[model samples]
Every structure is written in structure tokens, then in C-alpha cells.
Target: MRRPPMISLFTGAMGLDLGFERVGFELRLTLDINKFVCETIRANRPDIPIICNDIRRVSTDDILRKAGLGVGGPVVITGGPPCQAYSTAGKRRSVNDTRPSRGGDLVFEFLRVIREAKPQFFVFENVTGLLSAAIRHISFYERMRKKEHEIPPDARLGTAFEKILEEFISTGYRVKWSVLNAADYGVPQARKRLFIVGSRDGVDIPFPPPPTHGRPDSLDVIMGRKKPWLTLKDAIWDLRNRRDLEYLPFPSWGKYLKYVPPGGSWVDIPRELQREAMGGAFYSQGGRRGFYRRLSWDKPSPTLVTSPTMKATCLCHPDQDRPLSVEEYARIQCFPDDWKFVGTTQEKYKMIGEAVPPPLAFAVAKCIMKAVKEDPGNPYSDPHLKFNF
Candidate 1:
């Protein structure tokens, strides 16, 4: 059987799309609103068509025309819409975010394209925070003053996701979703993301693809049920001495990062200097582990944020005093060495940090391919399987 063609939306850095391509999916067209992101895509994969405009302004007709497909085309649509609004790392604005770029509503736009394009299958990826996001956000101060019961249903955890699932279901697709860790798929990073797969023909997509990697001491690894997790040493040890390394200069507190041992953070500094290194953040709540943090050679990295030098989310190199280089960021995200990102250093980092690790995407694409190939003609045995979470 011919592999299905693919159309990608919000194709930041083409990481997910590249994975599908590796699995023999022909990437028909790609779309994104960011100029630099589109430029990066064109720079590396010039043969693929692109729609570089706001998804809201780009109609279903435009997408279909660019991909040369009619409605109900044998295509797989995949994307990770901008996830900041639903991200736990942020203020959890949820669907109420009113940024000029229409942050959260982009998910709905993804749904719109799915509804109109009617592809054979579609894959939606986002931060795992989507699972617990409320449709309406209530500030922490306001919530503290009010009883739990006083909060409206819209403000309740998971309400936003419930609505999203309902929207997918309403489009007549059989949907399956799960939160998957990239490290489980051998990406050398423990980035956990939410993935939703749907079939328009009512075929149940087998999801939560079995993990192929695990912690060294885990039962799965010890018993040879899975390979040991890949680590930073496995991903970037060769590049340690590379002359072309590109990275951001560390912040003011970076002077203290040298005292932090590999795998350690703010707490590792001397007690007397900890206050000075952390400053006002010293009194902040929550684990400020990212402060003065240094990477460990033996472990899978913590999730890659857009900026590795932020006081609250630092991703210092294990031995080097500076932040992880842009090349290192690409390596951790599993981008091919030759893949070119066309933008400023910061833009490159943002693209790499936000990408869905290709290894994880390949695993998902393979799972979907296996299901489709094994039972192409049959409807799903049970279309009502609740989401795997």
C-alpha cells in the first residue's frame, strides 16, 4: 500500500513532519504563521510547499489547493498548535488568552482544518498541561479566597480538554489520546507531551505506543523488556569540543553556576552565597531548581524550554559555565545535524526548544501506519475506547 500523504499545520522546525517523512509519508504541504519558522522550513526542505500565513486567515480551500487534494483526501494532518496558553509553565490563560496572535484559539483552527479537510487521519500534539487546563482561568489570589465549589464549571480543571475532545468527536472522528514522554522513544529528553490521534472513518487508532526505552534501573530495562534510556552523554558528547558552538551568554547569577556540580541546582551552592546568587528568587515558592541548574551527563535532560538562560528555567551545560548551545538544543530535540534553521540565534533556539522530538513522532507515525496496514478495511472493534490519558 502507498504510504499516506501528509499536510502539516503549525510546522515549527518540521521536526514532527520529518519523522513522518522518515516513515515514508510524503509531506504534501506545510503551514505556519511565523516568518522565521517558514523560512527555516523552506531553507532545509525547499521542495515541500508552504503556506506562510495565520492559520485563521488561511482557509481550508487554500490548504487543499496547495496540497493538491480534495476533501476526504488520503492524507495525515499533523501539528502542534502554539501551546503557551495551556502550558503549566505559563499563567494558564487557557482559551481566554487574548494575545494578538490568537494563541489558544489556534487549537480550534486546527480542528477547523480537520473538519473541512476531512483527512483520513489527523494527529494533534501539545504540552501535557492541556489535560488539566480550565476553559476559563481564575487567578490564584481569587481562587484562594473562594471555596472550591464556588468556581464555575468552565474554570474547573480539564474542562478545556473535554471541550476539545468533544469538538473532535463532533467532527465524526474516532479519537485516541495519550501523554507520551519523548525519552520513552529514545529522544534523550524526558519531554512529556499530549498527543491526540483521530480517524475519520471510525477506525480506532491504537495509541500510547509501547515505550522502547526506560530508566537504567527500571524493571523494564533490568529485565531486558526495554533498552536503557538515552542520556546527554549519548546525544552530545562528541560535540563537546566542536569549534562552531553557538549559545547565549549566561545571566548575572551565572557566576555562581560554576559552583553547581553536574546534575545539581541552586541548593548545591554555599548557603551564604545561595541568597546572593538567587537574590529575590531566594524567597520564592516552589522548587527553584532551574536556578543555577547544571545538566547531568548520565541522565536524560529536563524538558527543553525556549530559553535555556532564564533565571527560572536555566539549562546550563554540564561542564561548561554557559547555557546549552543551539547545536546542543537541536541534538537534544533529535534534529538531524544537517538540518538548517534560518533565523537569529534566539529564534533558532525557540524553534528547537518547541519542536516535537522526531524520534517520538516517528514512533507515533509507525504506530498509526501499523494499525492502518493491519486492518485497512475493517471498522474499529470498539470505537468508544475512552482516552488513555
Candidate 2:
């Protein structure tokens, strides 16, 4: 029998690993720095090995020795590293930015694992902000903290992405990348994420799979609306009828929502409420987009986060006054209702919010599968290739 391809999941938070699990990939090993997330992986699958700490702190030789992948272990590694430093919503600081460890260096840590394990394939996921990240050589450049965030006089685009590609190629793999929307798969959210997959040159590396659910049934693929995108109503209405459906009022923002209608937000509040609602931001630019932003029943959901209740990026229900519960957020991310997190509500939200929706993961996985199927031939253990820098 041809064995199922085993997957070693890194930074396997929120059981986004579970999505890959659902699609028949046997998860052989899981790694995470958070003990809770690691424990969740263990609790759910007591049989699988879970390494519960930073990869930098873990011994590569020890991990390989334990996984028994010394030789002939055909494996694929998948993970979504914390990407705040590179996030569009965050300060677009460089890899050396003192903000935190969630920058390109963490990704390089993942590459370190790839170099040591020599996995046949690996998948990396992150927010689309990577499309514009930059790179610099320290000797030729000024310090990062020279006062303000000033792009180098001649900085080119995709420098960060290309640097990431170079890291994977250094580990002996051919790499390709693309951004994907969750709604293209069966997930109801319009979450967009960048996916990069690297395979040993000439072995097989598939392009992303075409949309399975939202295929066009209409005019120009770009402009026309085929089946309209999935909406919050498509997700929670059934739960609404159930007595178990959960809802909690945010003492701060939930009350103000009482006056806003379905598909309406702070702008919809009466002139009095708008003034009261906006307060300081009344004169703020940028559309105050999420303020009292009621989700529309006719469109896909905005990207979910660890804290939907937070106003900076609210994810409130289109009709209900309360913010979407952990359950609804999980659903929006395509997690099974019973897929429990082993942490506080905030932690659970963080796990769920940070994950690349599984449907999206599976869609990308299938693309890699297609690439493998097309060319199963082996490549030289020692290969010759140069990057087009």
C-alpha cells in the first residue's frame, strides 16, 4: 500500500493543523512554543508527538532522532508563524525591529528546521503584508532605529519575499508563492493569506488549486459575481434557532449596537449616537471602517482576529448586538464546533484568529498534491541551481 504522506506541523496553533488532518494527511509530529497549544494537540491526539517550545530552543538533532526521520522519511512540514512585524496592520518594521520576535527571523527559524530535517516539502502561511516587506544589508545601511520608519532611498519591492525564497532555496528546495482567499474554498470568511511552498527541485511542486466552491458561473471571472460570497447569516442563523447558541454583551460597545440595524455600523447610528459613538475619531480619516461596523448578511465576513470584541478591528454580528463568540469565530475559520482549545477565552480567540482557515490550507495542499502527482521522479541529492537575484 502506498503510505499516506506524513506531515510535521510547526507552530501548529489553533488546530489549523486539524484542517490538514481532515484532508487525510497523517500528522506525525507537531511543534509549538505555547504549552497550551501543544497540550491541545496532545489532548486531541494523544498518540502524536508534540514538541512544546520554541524551535530555536529545541535541538534539531534531538528532534530528528526522536521523530525517527534519520533516513527515508518522506515528510512535509506546514506552519503559520506569528507575523505581526510584517503585518500591514502593524508597524512595517524591519527584521531587526525591537517590537517582538514575530518577524522574518522567526520564519528563518522555520527554515532552520527545514535545513536540518530536509523535509521533501514545506508550507508557510502569513498575512499578505509580506508582499511589500523589504531587506537590507547592515554594513551598507544606517541603523533601523534612526528615528522614523524611512524606506531606503532605493528600496525595491518584494525584497523580503525574495529573501524568504532564498532561505528556502538554501535548504535545497524550489519555491513558489501565492495569496489565497478563504471563501474560494468552503470557508465562509473572506480571509486572505499568503502561502509559500518549497519542494526539492524537480521532485514536484504544485500550484494552488482552483476554487472548488466559488467557481464562476457567470461573466468575466474578475468582475461578475458568480454565487455571491458567503455571509454571517450563512454561518450563525442555524445556531440562532438553537438554545445553545452563545452571545455575550460587551458592556462597552455592545449597548451602542442596539440602535444600529442589520448590515449597519456606527455610521448608521443616529446623528446623536454618531457623535457619541465616534467621540474623538469623529474627525478621523480612513472611514472609521469598523466602528459600529455591522456585518452584512449578503457578503463574506471580514478576517477574524483573536479579539473580535476589540473595536480597532471589530467582528460583530450583522444583526445581533454582541460580538461573535469564540464558537462563531471558530466556525468562520472553518474549525469544527467540537474542536476545543486548551486555553482561556482570549487565548482561544488568539489561536483561532491567528490560524490560516483550514479550507484555505487544504486548497493549497491539494495544489501541491497535483504537482507531486504530475512528477514523482526523484531529483539529485546534490543539485545545481542559482537564484535569479
lDDT string for model 2 (1-389, tens) is 23335545455554456666665556666778777788777767788777777776887676666665653364577877777767766456645443335655778777777777777777888888777776642321354444335656324446777777677677768777788888877678878889888886546565676665563444433455335456667876676545554444565756778777776777777787776677788886674777776677767788886677766566677666778877787778877777767787777778778887877777776655555444535331212322111
- The residue-level lDDT of candidate 2 at 277 comes to 70
The whole-model lDDT of each prediction reads 0.87, 0.67
**For model 2, what is the alpha-carbon lDDT of residue 44?**
70
Best by lDDT: 1
Model 2 stretches with alpha carbons more than 4 Å out: 2-9, 98-104, 135-150, 153-158, 215-228, 242-248, 378-389
Q: Write the per-residue lDDT of candidate 1 for residues 1-389, one digit (tens) a residue.
A: 45577899999999999888887788999999899999999899899999999888989999999998899774589989998899888588888785735388888899999999998889999999899999999886787788879989899889999998899889888899999999999999989999999988776667878999999999999999899999999999999988789988986778988789999999999999989888898998886867887999999999999999887899999988989999999999999999998888999899999999999999898767655655546332223333231
Q: Which one is best on TM-score?
A: 1
lDDT of 2: 0.67
Estimate candidate 1's RMSD in Å. Answer: 3.9
Model 1 global lDDT (CA atoms, 0 to 1): 0.87
